[model samples]
Target: MKAQVLIRPKAGILDPQGIAVEQALPALGFGGVSNVRVGRLVELDVEDPEQLDAMCQKLLANPLIEDYEVLTSS
Candidate 1:
């Protein structure tokens, strides 16, 4: 089955990519933007659905500074 792991910074964490995007918005004519939080899309195939949560907890995110969500059969 397919799974997607989305890792994002925890609240109160500094997001450099998000900051960069926010600064660039005006240059790209998206002046209405204020804040941006950057994240990623990681797609993978897993043999066991039950392992999905464990996978994220063990390796997908840094528990101290990041948060993650897993999408199953994606």
Candidate 2:
């Protein structure tokens, strides 16, 4: 099975990269953009999908400052 992990900073956390992108959008002709949050995606091939959450909690995402979601590709 193919697994996908989406990791992102938790709410109320400061995101400098997101802020930079948001600030540059208007100059690039894109407007009305707000609350931009940056995140990362990880793809893996695994035999068991159930273990993905543990992987996220242990290695993929920082439990104190980030959140993650695991998805399986059918």
Candidate 3:
């Protein structure tokens, strides 16, 4: 099994990285790209995305402001 973890800044928080990426998207040949939010993609060799989500809320991410989703594939 594998897990993909997306660690991003919480809403209403300052994300300079995301902002920079959003501004550079058009210059990088990406058309109509707006509101780009940069995040981290962590692919883990594991069992469940749900379990990972729980782990994220518990340890990986801050549930107070951050939003996250889980998807599992076999």
Candidate 4:
């Protein structure tokens, strides 16, 4: 199976990278863009699809300050 994990900072958490991108957008001639956020995507092949959640909770993301979503495909 092929799996992808999308990891991002949780709401109400301070996101410096997001802020920087948001600010830069306006100056670069892109207007009306707001609430910019930065996230990461991790793709992998796994034998057991059931273990995807465990991998996310244990090492792929920091549950305290981050949120994650897992996607799987055959």
Model 4 lDDT per residue over 1-74, tens place = 99999999999898999999999999999999988989899999999999999999999999999999999999
TM-score: the better of candidates 2 and 4: 4
Ranking by TM-score: 4, 2, 1, 3
lDDT of 3: 0.73
lDDT per residue for candidate 1 within 2-70, as digits (tens), equals 888898888899999999999998998877897699987779998888988877788778778888998
Off by over 4 Å in 4: none
Candidate 3 per-residue lDDT over residues 1-74, each given as its tens digit: 76666777788887788889888888889888767787766667775445786688797677776666655556
Poorly placed runs, candidate 1 (over 4 Å): none
**Candidate 2, pairs of clashing residues:** none
* Alpha carbon deviation, residue 23, candidate 3 (Å): 2.0
What lDDT does each candidate get?
0.86, 0.93, 0.73, 0.95
Model 2 / residue 55 / CA error / Å = 0.5
TM-score of model 1 vs. true structure: 0.89
Candidate 1 vs 3: which has more TM-score: 1
Off by over 4 Å in 2: none
> Which residue pairs show collisions in model 3?
none
Please give the lDDT score for candidate 1.
0.86
Q: Quickly count the clashes in candidate 4.
A: 0
Q: Give the residue spans of candidate 3 off by over 4 A.
A: 28-31, 47-50
